[model samples]
Target chain A: MTDESRPGVGPVSLATVAAQAGVSIATVSRIVNGETRRASAETVERVRQAIKAVGYHPNQLGRALRNRESRLVAMLAANLDNPVMATIAASTEAALRQAGYVMILCDTHDRPDLQDDYLNAMRSQVVQGYVMVASQPSPGLRDFVERGAPMVFVSRRSPFGECSFVGPDNIAAGSAAADYLLDRSIEEPAVVYPSRESSTTRERVKGFCDRVIARGIPADRIRRADGPGISHLEIGYAAAQHFSAPHAWPRGAMCISDQVAYGVHRLARESGVQIPHDCEIVGIDGSPLNAWLAPWLTSVEIPHPEFGPSIVELLVSLWGGEPPREHLMPHRLAAALER
Target chain B: MTDESRPGVGPVSLATVAAQAGVSIATVSRIVNGETRRASAETVERVRQAIKAVGYHPNQLGRALRNRESRLVAMLAANLDNPVMATIAASTEAALRQAGYVMILCDTHDRPDLQDDYLNAMRSQVVQGYVMVASQPSPGLRDFVERGAPMVFVSRRSPFGECSFVGPDNIAAGSAAADYLLDRSIEEPAVVYPSRESSTTRERVKGFCDRVIARGIPADRIRRADGPGISHLEIGYAAAQHFSAPHAWPRGAMCISDQVAYGVHRLARESGVQIPHDCEIVGIDGSPLNAWLAPWLTSVEIPHPEFGPSIVELLVSLWGGEPPREHLMPHRLAAALER
Candidate 1:
């Protein structure tokens, strides 16, 4: 039989797609959203049959209007000057654009009140999803989630069980840095990273600490320093000042972010401490600019590009009525600076 | 004493404020928008009195809703990785926030189609104002302007004459850079900047070139090269490669952006061009992190903090119904990286 002669042949709309597919409108919406559910063989077959019978291409904006959805995604960033966050925002936006969505970029500047305000403001915008990078969610965030807008956390972990997350494997990143430093036979390693409070910083430190302990390094042999989470370079300089003094320095060091690594480089140069020879160093977040930094950053490559795809998958699934889950993407330890 | 007994006592709506203040509501709105208008001393006093008497806090949001006006401002940026734009966005947002407004940031990634799409989307949102930083204005941009959203160009100058603009004094920055380089007595000079098509880059180059010509050096004597606008380090590397040949190289150079300066530094180092001795360089946009780059960056400081106040002044003025005009902010060149 010719394609046009098939039964249930018609133009695809919410109604026709639902009826011919033998499913409810909500089910069709869920299927389109890519929700996690196993449809019955017969129902799935019917839907597939209907979809094929009528070339139904759902109008994103039309559906959004009907649901009062903005089709606009909000990305809350704590700081953009931090290359890591910039990279994350750029990649995430790129992904969002491909998925037929416009992202509203909001910089919270690590202020609780501002963060709350943006969250509150977002509530009236009819936004479909939210993406936050290393931001501390406030009461407004909970209210937003309750309003049925799916949210994804990037570079930050949320205590809220319902929100999905996409970020680098911080634990592995830390462990790899330790291994890199130790592989070069640096016994006493010092770790300097941003904010002692940030989960990202803590996770990296944890991995490095675990690995250093696993390698038989004494607890006292490892030194730790914390600085402003976003201003890694500033912290690196501070760490360097302490390290430059004869009694204050550690034998080896790993920076929490590439920006901090840049600071360490400057300090080492100013103090005449040769990298890898004086104090081997590594940074995380593997910004592309690291390649051009003076000594080229020996950093953990946190698949910044993959963030775009991963975020889309999560958002699409959520829109499809799927439950939220945390996703951890693997990182590559680029020892570019070592050579 | 009763409100009537007081000098400021009256019916304090538009009429009272107008009657007591001896100014029209339009004038009050203009003052609120930060427009520079000459209101009589008595009028100013009366307006203040009327405002205080009636507690006339402008309901920006409420007014917007009733009139189908979106007090939301849309900012179209090419890239957030460029810290300058981020700083500007942050500053602008802060200014708008104080006025009970929020900014919608869209990254066009230098694509005309994306810019068009974003413009259309912003139009649909009924944004009160628009700010764009784009090197080239597409057809969609023209259409957007015609559709009647008051827009101000930042950094990027549009070919159209109708739009208002807010940008740094590029000529001053360039001359300042040249002055710094010459004060150091580096005779042979090279220039590395983004593509000449960029308004800022062109302005900087013209200023620098003019200074060089005035110093009795022929225009052709300057070693100049333009690279892909995206990567700063690449431009730096290219500069280094050009100057670090086995033969003679320029003794000094100025980069368009700090990111580009980093690249130049890397290339110079790789080519064994010693900074401040064999070569010295200056960069634009004095980012805080510039000091962290190895050897730091000698850059022209653009006042990022003031961006918020300036943008708000312009936006509020437009909101109050003023015609478009240009505003220029000054810059200072600082010796960030000195040997």
Candidate 2:
């Protein structure tokens, strides 16, 4: 079969069109690359017709190689199932598009192996930079950083501590959650977190514990509920099992994430425990859907919409050879937590 | 500044490494491309050291151009905020990664302009195939199809036809929803949909109306709530505004999506309308989170996990020159609707 008729055969090349147009390959390349000023109108028209006749699809790979640039950036995210991650990705995609860069999003699902695979693949694709959301440290990532690749962390900080980061102040969020519960006269509040492996979780837990202790609540009075950290919702649900009875539950609690709060709420409803009336709960990462879906849940709202712009700005700054910087976005109490 | 020290000056090419190693550029290329058998062990080691010393980063673009394959596929989706879309994307990415192809996910947010932009960008990137999730067709998409590119439609069919589709049978889902309400001895059920423009919505509406009409319910008796169709949640919430009073709401309703159902549920709770007791609601796209988050809202569960494998299988088939075929996955009533 002819090249054009073959299914997986490569498209007609610039050489084929150049041969058909009876012009030099360089001339064809110039016209195809939009450098029409160097070619005569007649020659350009002839080359264009030859391109159509031969069905030549200008290979972007070739063009990018020639220009020594690929306007592609990869966003390696831990999870997309989390609405917060999805929101961040959506907004980041828009911001990147506006800046004339196409984003390639890869979901690592918080697996180190998958993260490495994506990192290696991205390298092969020559992605200009990376935006890692809740990234886990891996040898591949470290290698890329060592190579001086531009990258920015979002919603988490790099363990290596040399990359730019854009996220909410987790310690403050934890402190605020503590203060909110304490102000409500709930003296013995608990903090439920998936795992301390995450920088955000560790900082939040630290802040919560420190604040509760400083407020004259004995350290032992501040209960701690921990889970395997695989799934936030499952973590909260499993943690709540320890306090199966309504009276066994603390007067107030702080969940590391909104999803964890949902889990707690689910278990509480099943166990006949009323929210706020029995156990006031606060969560972080106030999802955009809270206003419509969970208006009653009081939580520290991370500005997810602003994350896209902040991440893109940091990436640009990194690309411009600026020293690594950290941007702490402001957070606020959303819904019932505002009071 | 030397290329190694200059940021974004392009990586040190194979030529540089070859020159430093005192070998032909072709030899260096073969060795770097993993053709180690063709080079002497000593030469290979020398080349490797030269590569490191010169800070050479292999450009995949040039390699891809030579191979006439990118090992990349682009998923152009309508919206990522929708949990269903995010689920599909995550699963598809895993499947594609397993098949040795990296997915580039682009969220168009249901805008025609953005769709066109992503399409154009993907073409320039030379994506091998496309997985369109509820895609809005545009001139660029038409051009790609006209060029005989491989593509598969997910959760929606291509408007132009001739493309493989993988999704739940929406008509059956709608009929099931209607049957579910009718079995409860509830008559005068209303169908709430964001827009009939979507193939899924159109089919669901048809099935619901047909089933209702066939059951002796007059066409006029079945109230239809419509919204501008921008946001599914807002659509359902706005549609619920017509039935502001608890008594005004129909005894049963079928929401086009789970998200829309959430909107209706939100409004119903605000209006003091008890679910199932005052109004029973059924939705489509039973999100994975429903078991944990929305067990009470009945929904037709689309097999989102299966979607990834099915879409990848179809893409492979299309690549192998097989004729386009439709694969309608099985859907079942989830949660309370099962009975």
Candidate 3:
């Protein structure tokens, strides 16, 4: 009755351990899988010894086949080159690890086809869950979720479908920036917003511009320029150059991210436009590193330490049913002038 | 005979397509698996239509089971928050993807136990290869390599075992920094070296200190302080405070990384010290962002753009057998002194 006589069970399996320990297959399996409460003390020890004697590496894949789901979680990132993305990713990965799952990091490089391919691959792997910083949600993504995949969208909610999302309240973040500029009584305020339109980006821009116009500041007074989704620093620098050419440099500027603000600072120095004395600048995404590395980032900052972990928690909560509601992480505007 | 009559094959498997099309299994497989040129056009078109009608999802898992390997590549990282590490990962992941493998990122957070657990889990999963920036090599790492896992170390060679390494020549980078400081006639030079001892860091410190001693200057004149391996910027800020308390502030500081240099600059500004006029700083890891964000960083820098991709290339060349030797990429001192 030994599995050694079976054609394909192989020499290193639960049957082999059971045969060696002179126990039932059920007893050996329970011991190997850490369900040892039912077995006798002597039996547990015997099976443990047998496992080592046979050099048995527990077959997680075969176990996963029975569960019909891999303990692997796949993350689709728009791009990995961005440090902010890293900040988000680091947070998500740490949280997932704590919950007993491994993450497969896939960078779609913002291409629809590549994103589709990874989604297709995920099905083949039977991964337990999906999380993403999606770029232009396609039918492939919707299809994955529709098939009842445990998925959560981070940074921006999917425009194509209603689902769980965990990110900063961009509208509020944007409005806060406008309020800061207005309270300082600055004239000729401007912005460097990314050309890419996510619900997240669009909300930030609308909040800022709408608040400015609401306060009787004409829309024309708010000079605006486009930056790409990634590499906002260089784009911010170029935006500065473009803004400088049209007229007198604005006395104050609001940037969508810290990199854009840094870019503006660098270009202004090159052009001999003194900060604060000539023109003051403020930015969003108040990264902790900005405090030490780019003090010039003096505006709305997302709470990364709290934001990242929350995304993972939200995903886990949805395991049994729907997420309670969309989670909104907090943001801060550090208005204290560079000390 | 129809695959419907087959005992075990699923409805959407390759066998189903073959049976429905009245063709041999090999002909259906070649066309379905992208071996289109080997099959006749009539056969290819018939198979393609059958695939659509049946909604066949390719069974990569079954193929992997037969081959006794997974197409997944596992990367063990020390820290992902640091942008320099991101550069290495981006390069490695991109190259691996182009070669038809997906990367599973595992950050050990510089813990030996976590490293060992990940190594153990890797064996359970049958990951085809391993690449790492090992914090401190242990028996777990040794066992994996001894068992013939395809592994390539980046940043520095294994601290415990012989292996293929692809990273900067830290000693050369260090010596070059020393030359820059001395040539500038820095009166009271200092260094902010990482407290962690990797072969890379050890060589850099040794090179810098050795070169200083070789010169007419005494070793004591070279002010020395410690910074963390990652988070060099904040640590640099702290190190600046540590260095400032002991006698006069050094005029030039050699930082272990560019982030450290930026930290020093921030601290100096707070202390009312002028850069270049008061304290000139040079750093290693010449990140491209340093050119714009930290023009103040002047010293030998890692060719990340070159170094990252090279690590991947080296790992690939060693796939069939051991790499003939480790790779040492080039570095340069950017002394342009910002515009």
Candidate 4:
């Protein structure tokens, strides 16, 4: 039982306890595996004492295989480096733990090959379900969908459209961003985005463009700055080159995300372009940290804290054989409008 | 085997494939589990064909139990909401994946109770090893250490001083910060920290205070500001109140982390104090994002990217039965001092 006694020996096993208790291995196995009905009460007590004496650790892997349940849930995220994704991951992990499931997080790094590898690995591990965050369509994902796997997509919808989704109404968020800028007397506001590859970004851009054009702002007058869709900060920093000049700057600008907005702000400062006085900027992804770390940024806030419980609820419903449904969480502009 | 034909049917099992192949279940299991040497070539061919036809997925849980290897690693982090932690998690996950292991992340939220729960849960799941990030000593942790579990502490050393550690040299980083400020002709400087509960913060503060005092500054003039140790940003923001006024402002300041430095900067700007000109500030945790998003923050950069591979390597060494060792990664100042 003590380290001093077991110098280079392997972990204590059922056989060791069985030998120590003067019982058959079957009796020890039955007692250790919770099949005590097969053994007498006195025999079970003897086996328990032997197990404690030998420091026997039950093999959960064997138990999980026999029960056909690992109680392991996998979360395949596009990137964990993003604050939004990290926030969602933290909340989801807490929620999963509360539900008696351990969450296995795999970062796909936004690569299809990596996603495929993680999916295959998680499948082999026999995870009960999955939560995909900003996932992309891959053959492995399609196979999971075809096989009727329980999954929920967060911050993005499944391209296959069969799984449940939990995210903000990004289109409405974009429209709100546009309206906020226009209401501040800024005409010909610019919209900066990394790429339209993601549904969130594509829909947000669509909503902003449609609303601005409907309000009589000429399509050509509304500047649209797009970048290589890599790092959000890099995208915003690159976009700033086209708008940092006093003559080129729009009276107002909306960035795809808070990180991008920060990039724009950093570049503008370096370029001697004063915010509010020269041009106002707004961002999305109202991360809670912004309240203390980034008070200057005005953004449409997504309910990141609710994402964990909502996603878990949707996943549990899926497990109960409920029809897949979409859950659209609300978004609102955060921070004061005044410069 | 198709979804339509197998409507309401359970997943294909080894027996299903064995029946389809006209072979014993044991024979089919052998071929599927990569023990083809036990079966004839024709039998292996038949089992492979039947597996494809019946859409059977091997139960890795069973094989893992037999092999005594789960290929599962758990990472226990204090907080994931912090960008530094998020960056480390992403890189660590990638490195783990590259090593053919899946990482299950557990956020302890800096609570010992949560840490205990995660430790117990991970133990039940039979993780091969652990990577503790800013871990606090707990009974479960002590049990693991006593039992000789393979674990490595990242960003902080084990409070028990019995496990491998992979992190930056905090003392050197703090000394670098002090020298950076002193070289800039700032006679009086302030140090803002959340708490000294963590080894990283404690060492950094000790290094800064020691170096400054050795260089002839009075210990009382060091102006150490400590907060409730809840939120790093709030700590910095609160500390800023003591130095916002012109009479109270030190010519220079050193913050615990980049997040805390951002809080100070935000507060100073609101209080009409200009950075660099009013009070030169330095921060630790040179997050890669700072290059594009926070060009104004001069920080001592910890090589976040290198942490992943280094931690993985240390864990592998421990698994190989090597003695526990400490890895102190190098740190240096990032960005221009002219800011």
Best of the candidates, TM-score: 2
Per-candidate clashes come to 8, 0, 2, 0
Worst 10 residues of 4 chain A by lDDT: A3-12
lDDT of 1 at B202: 84
Sliding window of 10 residues with minimal summed lDDT for model 2 chain B: B1-10
For A1-339, candidate 1 gives per-residue lDDT tens digits of 233221111113557678777679887777766652766666666776776565454544344434545567888888876767777888888888888888888889887788878865764455667887877857756544554457788888764555788998898999999999899888888898765468887888899999999999988888887665446777777766756574456767888778788887777767777765666778888778666654556888888878878988898887787888778999887776434
- In model 3, the clashing pairs are A286-A301, B286-B301
Per candidate, native contacts kept equal: 0.26, 0.50, 0.33, 0.45
Which is better, 1 or 3, measured by DockQ? 3
- lDDT by residue (tens digit), candidate 4, B1-339: 454213112245778888889999999877776789988888888888998777677655555656656788899999988888888888898899889888888899988888988877776666778999998888777767777778889888887766899999999899989988888887788998885468889988888888888788888888877666668878788878877476688879999788888778778877777786788888999977566545667899999888999989998998788999889999988954346
Which should have the higher lDDT, number 2 or number 4? 2
Question: Across residues B1-339, which tens digit of lDDT does each residue of candidate 1 receive?
Answer: 223211111111354555556678887766545563677666666677776654354434334434556557888888776778878888887788888888888888877788878876665554667778753668877754654457778887776666777888888888788888877777767788865367788888888888877877778878886676466667567656655483566778888778788887777666777765676778888877666654556788888767777777876777677887778888886775657
Chain A: TM-score in each model: 0.77, 0.91, 0.87, 0.92
Candidate 3, residue A115: Cα displacement in angstroms equals 1.6
* lDDT digits (tens) for residues A50-161 of candidate 3: 8766656676656665555466777888877777777878888888888887777888887778887887776566566778775557777765555455677888787556
What candidate 2 gets wrong by more than 4 Å, as runs, is A1-12, A15-24, A41-58, A337-339, B1-12, B16-23, B33-38, B44-58, B337-339
Candidate 2 residue-wise lDDT, B1-339, digit = tens = 254422243656778889899999999999988999989999999999998777676766666667767788999999998889999998899899899899999998888788888876776676778999998878767766666778899988987768899998989889999998898887899989885468888999989989988998889989898777678988989888878678899999999899888888788878889876788889998876666656668998888988999999999999898999999999988855212
Q: What is the lDDT of residue B154 in candidate 1?
A: 84
TM-score of 1: 0.79
Shift in Å, residue B35, candidate 1: 33
Which regions of candidate 3 deviate over 4 angstroms?
A: A1-31, A34-47, A53-55, A245-247, A336-339, B1-55, B227-230, B245-247, B336-339
DockQ of 2: 0.50
